[model samples]
Target chain A: MKIKKNIPLIDQHDKNGFWGKFGGNFIPETLKKPVEDLTILFEKLRKDKKFIQERDYYFKNWLGSPTRFIKLENLTDHLDGAQIWTKVVSDLNGGAHKSLNATVHCLLAKRAGKKYIVGDTGAGYAGKMLSMAAKKFGLKCKIFMGAKDIKRQKPNCDAMRANNAEIVPVYTGSQTLVDAVSECMRYWVSNCDTTAMCVGSTVGPNIFVKICGWSTSQISKELLIQIKDEFGEIPKKLKLINCVGGGSSSFGFWNEFMHYNKKQVEFIGVEAGGPKNSKKHAAPLTYGSKIGVLHGAMQYVNQDAEGQIEETESISAGLDYPGVSPLHCFLKDTKRARYTAATDEEALNAYQLVTKFESLNPSLEPSHAFAEAIKIAPKLSKDTVLCINSCGDALKDRDILKKRLGK
Target chain B: MTVSPISLAFKKCKKEKRPALLTYTVAGDNTKKKSLEILNSISKYVDICELGFPHNTPIGDGGQIQTASYRAIKNGIKMKDIFQIVNKFKNRKNSKPLILMGYYNMICRYGENKFLNKCKQVGVNGLIVVDLPWPDNKKFAKKCKKKSVTFVQLLSPTTSKKRIKKIINDSHDMIYYISMLSTTGGKLKISPKKILENYNSIKKINKSKNIVIGFGITIKTINSLKKADGLVVGSAICNEISKSINNRQNPVTNVTNIVSLLKKRIS
Candidate 1:
């Protein structure tokens, strides 16, 4: 069946409504009206030139953007047949792709007249981003994280504390992403009058998705220039691949590429396959799940026939979730993007190969994306310059690497 | 408030001068056959019945309802089985319509149209979707009309006059006014005067439909709402069944005792 292209997701031209299959606000009853209020107030704030000017000042002076992209010369030589390039998102002010988005969200919240910000973070990158942004904006910030994550990503927790952000460690339901998100929603419900829960990924159908989408523009903008300069011609098969760790990076790349339909570039989304064939992975789109809304957004989910969520797991903490970005669901259904998975071992091997050859370490989450590149690279010739997003650095995964692989 | 077609069916079967006894049991709480026997025995006394479809996360539900839902789900109560339970009740001599009350997540997962069609095929008289926002879905009401099923709407004291009018206008089934803002069980203090006033107001707006009060309706409260079309009691009776569980054995005697006691309240 031929799936329709460019599904109507956004409300107005600037609004981010739905992406191919994923993205919508699927929130609990208590947070519904408050989210609507935030949406309207945010629209009003987004237009204020003063807010934009203040945000630009902070981005340039506080969170430095235009972070230089490093060419992986050593890795390209080792790969032999492939011209490999990885975006050094860690060079950004907050040291991850999250800063690019979280700062935007914090500024948006300030413009919306919100006094405080509440958010859930699994990898702790987004929490740090929100904390720093909140500090610059002179607003309070609260971050909910998994208890296990609190111990694993202590550096981020400390950074958030340094920014004077409130840290809440949640221990419910595997003590992971699901629980932190639940706690964040609870906090939003209680403090909706004073705060806006800024989601870091394109997970929810809120301003956070738009913020993340905008942040990811760096990848597309940089790639557009780099590809043109290196190839001396606009490349043909411009396949955009990204790790689906709540889909922020994928959205960043896809948002820029989705408009180029005639390019006919296949957008590939890679989710973690923790232990392939085992029930320990976060492949919600591939497995049969219901198309109900969550986190105040409508999309496909790993819900039972009755629409209750089924628990999902993975080796990478950030990718281990029972849900996906709703727009991804739409994309998958409409065939705009093909959603697939790679095993834990494959990602680990790819992660090591990138670090050993390129002399650049990447977060385990993006290694899943690399794994996909490795699979597709063997099929293409030297002409193929597959752009796989390197979402974060290996510093975040040092402990994870030690536990999974001996030093 | 005068009873509407759906609640009137429940009120018709209710014994006069007796509290309307409603059985609270999971569709497949124990084994399917065992649950069926419990339903058959309880059906003899109760005026209206509620069959809960179990789920993994029964949020907003207290311990008793949660346990009941777990047992039913564990015993394999698929959405298809709910229709069979209602069908069995339809085959019985009862005049009340078998009502299925559950969360919206379950309905969404099950495909709303498919579930409604199954409900109609099984001869279910009414449905209480806990998640369906009231009056906002006229299309859903139209679907219920086609199936001859009453789409139940909840009206709490928090419901304003404007909201109530919208609910009454949109509702295909009788109005189900929650006694309190809390979950289905617990010792809640509900004002009879408030219920009477809500009921009176609903009647004034549309005397065509029945207005039953649920969430918290004990014998005392039921008597107080004598002007009410009927009383809908649940978690309390399920709590009673839960107390009698000794070594996972079916608490048939407890179910019988609760029904008799509830019937005696009106008598």
Candidate 2:
């Protein structure tokens, strides 16, 4: 298999990890050396032929890459406007696109001679994938999860435990993803010598964002080819939509298509808006949050005037975060992508509609993207093709769906 | 350049042949008044006073300091109230040099120039933003220098020699050496001898800078690290306050007593 040679948009960050003044390494002094080492090692590994071959082998064999890109014909007929399609990343092993990053990082940790892999999770998909990957790579895994999230995401927790990963319950502020990341960083500070932190999303310091983005960019690398194979040419007017919690899947899905003209290819990112009538949504980018540092990266953050990070509310635990990925912040500022929010009610409605029309279940995170796509599909012409990234399956969200949707 | 109050305190400690005893307590740990009382009482034995601004999320801190910050923020401690405490501390006679330490988001939210000006107005001699390390802090440190506020640079065991030279070269009158690879208040992971060894390597880069060792500096470990220019005890003090609050004792007396004991041990 020949490796493609194209400069990815994710590699445009400066030496300090700033993507036009969005991301930087705003970490503690103890993490400086480790982060720098990881950066150097990642730069070398990404360019190494052997490393690429190893990563590609796993992408092909383990994760079932080039995940099905199928047109949602029934859903498109129901909407009666644009041709709706989906990159079914939900079909990947571990049931989410997170496996791609987790596989890459676990491999990197193995090459770096690390004995332990540590990570934090909000929705538990990342944690489950990391645990599975760590088990595959024969490394010890410890996952830090918020106590509240542990209750809601019990199945994923059980999955992680089944994979022999230790779950460290974080009882700090808000008992959510933000605090979990903070605690994970604190734990990494003490154990960095023997541990590699597989940050869940593109929301951490420069190296993490770069690593996650690079690993997940395989999504678009496949989608670009699938698009040509299906349509015999890139569609004249195409819209790619994906949900943005920490914006990993969206960045992955949009990275290769970024170089296309904005007129020909439109990028839309949907954020969780919590409840319809409440102001306590996790739509930092859509709500225009100020730039502030959280978990070692400067990004659009939901912070009070006094700079205290505010607690976020969303039905999807994965999207219930106060800060967004710095790369998404950059894309929002540069007008390279249009960002909006889908309230919980709209997302639930999308989940029901997609299940009824297409017989497919998406996690609430990507349900936001489907909600946005459903809303806008009717406004576009029939010739227009809109693709949404179904990044994860809703199996782990059964408790939430049962409670909210009454089974 | 004229000597700053922080430099003067280090000089006094050098004259006495002892490491300057620095005590850190979160501002408004239990309440604004009690926090100020703790500061005032501890200042008698402390060479330099470090007051931390309570944050909702203090990532660099461990469990003890996080509890203290929660208590302070629960009591509705605001930025203005912290500045008021500093102002009141400075109003008293013979008050030691006070340094404000916290995460940088608060300063960024409060406006860098305005926060530094408020520190200057409240007699804050130095500032230590834990998350702001080298290169990222260069501009803010320059701003602090212009305002006569020493922006404390932090050195860790993990910092490379090249980076150490760069940080020490750009350091102000005072530098803080994190004694180990842990958050504030963690148990000392390395022996005092090893910590001093690391400290000496950084001191060799610039002996003129007043360097202090912080993190995991508890009662059992303070005496062994007395050979350094200064030693900072934060988690132990915060733990004492927590104990006093839980036991319904006067935190001021109990905290001051422990600080005095730490000072004696270092001496």
For DockQ, the strongest prediction is 2
DockQ of 2: 0.81
Candidate 2: where are CA atoms >4 Å away? A1-7
State interface RMSD in Å for all models. 4.9, 0.9
Candidate 1 at residue A202, lDDT? 75
Per-residue alpha-carbon lDDT of candidate 1 for residues A189-270, written as tens digits (9 for 90 to 100)? 4456678778878776555565566656656666667667776755676677788868877777666566566345668899
Every candidate's DockQ is 0.19, 0.81
Across residues B138-227, which tens digit of lDDT does each residue of candidate 2 receive? 999999999999999999989999999999899999999998889889998889999998888889887899999999998999999999
- What are the lDDT figures for the candidates, one per model? 0.69, 0.92
Looking at model 1, give its docking quality level. Answer: incorrect
Model 2 clashing residue pairs (backbone): none
Model 2 chain A: weakest 10-residue lDDT segment is: A1-10
Give candidate 2's error at residue A274 in angstroms: 0.8
